[model samples]
Target chain A: MREINVAAITSCVRQMCMDANYHLSPDMQARLFEAAETEQSPLGRQILEKLKENLEIAAADQIPICQDTGMAVVFVEVGQEVHLTGGDVSSAIQEGVRRGYQDGYLRKSIVRDPLTRVNTGDNTPAVIHYTIVPGEQVRITVAPKGFGSENKSRLFMLVPADGVDGVKKAVLQTVREAGPNACPPMAVGVGIGGNFEKCACLAKQALLIPTDQQSEDPQIRKLEQELLAEINKTGIGPAGLGGTVTALALHVKTYPTHIAGLPVAVNICCHVNRHETMVL
Target chain B: MDCRISTPFTKEKAAELHIGDMVYLTGTIYTARDAAHKRMMEAIRQGRPLPFDLHNSIIYYMGPTPARDGRPIGSAGPTTAGRMDAYAPTLLDLGETGMIGKGRRNEAVRQAVIRNGAVYFAAIGGAGALLSKAITSAEVVAYEDLGTEAVRKLTVQEFPVIVVMDSKGNDLYEIAASKYCTE
Candidate 1:
């Protein structure tokens, strides 16, 4: 068995949080550039150009791309043969978020309680998802999710009769409602199948897929491409002021489910979809 | 329409703006978001003085990151204004003439804007780092404990924003969307 200290995870999480906030992923940036070049609306093109400029400023100055530096959402994949030591993995990851937000000057956006609504002061208690996999290594991904888009995410539990068209209708409806609110052009993360909570997680995890890359599954790839085209036809455009590119890409993940139910979850992300991954 | 304007906007000054006008604002403004707005309203209920002037003043719905060394502010972008919808109409009634934010406002906010002849500007959302470049200086004026959500007095120069909803009730969102929506 490979022994790993939780401290290493902490350090990795810390850097990932800061790095993700400061830099837009290259593939996503390329999408924005492509959108700028192809967008027909004058204002939409202008907005896309400004977004690119915003990314450059964030990277060069090492500041967050957006003030809503977002709540840190982490995904951990641990090899089944690995033994964790030195500290608890959960606490270690939380500590990383706290230190990263504090040291990096990223905004501390978490609240102590949903009811009382007091700031936690340090961004902490990262929403963590874990999986046990094959190798002896631990992989951690940090995606700072901004609430503007997060607030617009939706989950629909459809009866089996709803089928694929139902899923499409649900997604399109969610995106249409999100409109200017989700900060279009958006990257839609869709999860189909699985149980309720699992489907929600899948939607979020789908967002981690490289936007430029397409699903290898031919059917899924076709659906993704079709969705992207239909969404852009929305004319919600760059900042939702109207254009041909409402969304940059759609990341869809599907799994097996119960015979009676069809569950679909859409986790919407704004143009500033910030995420970073590290392995140790 | 590319327009240049300064703050401390009166009803008449604000009325000059129309939906679709791309404006660059230079002058003083205040910042407040969810927590600070609640506190301000609570203070008003308690018959206490507000932290800053409200007359003809513009409030930016934002919560910014901490500034790094030698900088006056950090990445400062508009937050979703809809979150502040509950407080916006009341603030507009109190003579606050302008609000800078992103996203559509509630019907009440739109009504308030027209009733008071106030203007609502849309700052490019997700462009915080670029937006910060326009803010020359920032100082927390109230609710210090609110951290990023504190009310800040800011001096901005050539701050770019678009007139999303104007005093006359023209909404750029509807106007612009109709121009391009294929679906």
Candidate 2:
């Protein structure tokens, strides 16, 4: 078995956090450009132009793209053949988050306690998810999630008989309810057919998929394309002022569920959907 | 139409604004979000003086990231306004005439705006990096312990916004959404 140093993990996480906040991924930038070109409303087009300019400024100045730099979320795919050395894996990740937010001059948005509501000073205790795989490599993805869209996420347990139409209705409803609050021209992540909690997790995970990529499953790919068209038809537009480019992309991820249930989750992400991945 | 306005916005000036008009605001504005709003409401109830006078003042619902060295503030942009709906009418009654935020205000908040001759402006959400260039200066005036959520006094220059809700209760969100709604 190959051993990976926890210190190395810390440093990797730290840099990924900083980079993710500073740079708008090229896929997201390209999609925004396409959205702007095709958007119907003049005001919507102007807003999209400004958004593009803002990202350019962020990249040039090495500043964050948005004020809410987001809570650090770490997704790990660890190989069963690899052993972690030097420190506990979770603490290493937290330290990385703490240093990243602190050194990067990003916002420290986490609270020490949900009830008492004291700022944690350094953004730490990152939400971490781990899955073990067969190889000797460990993959880590850092996604700093801002609360604006996070507050808009929803989960529903649908009766299996309701089927695809039910999924469409639920996704549309969530986007409508989000309106401008979640920040329009959103990237919608839909997770279907899992248990309730798993579905929600999968929905969030789907958001990590790059905007340029579509699901390999033909049916799911078609659904993603259809949902994108229907959402834009709402004219919620960029900044929800009104336009034809309401959603950048709709990512759908699915897993097998029990015979009686089809749990669905919608995790809405703003256009600044930031994530970075590294393998070691 | 584009209009340039100064803050401590008066009833007459606010009435001149209609839904969907683009506005660029200059002069002093205060920043407050969930925590600061809650505290301001409580202070008003207790009859204590506010950190800043409320008359005709405009408040921006924002919690900006901390500044880098030599910067007044980091990417500052409007947060969701609906979270403040509970405390907004009380502020309106206290003579606060304008608010800057993103998203749809509740019906009650819109009514309060009409009743008090106030206006609500929408700054583009998730455009913090772009918006920060307009803030000339920022300083915490109250609730300093709240960190980013503290009430900050800001000097702004040509900060862009759209008049989303006017003194007469016209709402851009409703108008725009309905305008584009497909049959």
Best by DockQ: 1
Candidate 2 segments exceeding 4 Å error: none
Two-chain DockQ for each candidate model:
0.85, 0.75
Off by over 4 Å in 1: none
True contacts kept of each: 0.82, 0.65
Per-residue alpha-carbon lDDT of model 1 for A1-280, expressed as tens digits? 9999999998888899999999989999899999999999999999999999999999999989999999999999999999999988999999999989998999999998999988999988789989999999998999999999999999999989998899999999999989888889999999999999989998998998999889999999999998888888877887779899899879999989999999999999998888999989
lDDT of 2: 0.91
Best by lDDT: 1
Q: What DockQ results for candidate 1?
A: 0.85
TM-scores for every predicted model: 0.99, 0.98
Worst 10 residues of 2 chain A by lDDT: A57-66
Q: CA lDDT, every prediction?
A: 0.92, 0.91
TM-score of predicted structure 1: 0.99
Going through the candidates in order, what is the number of backbone clashes in each? 0, 0
In order, the B-chain TM-scores come to 0.98, 0.98
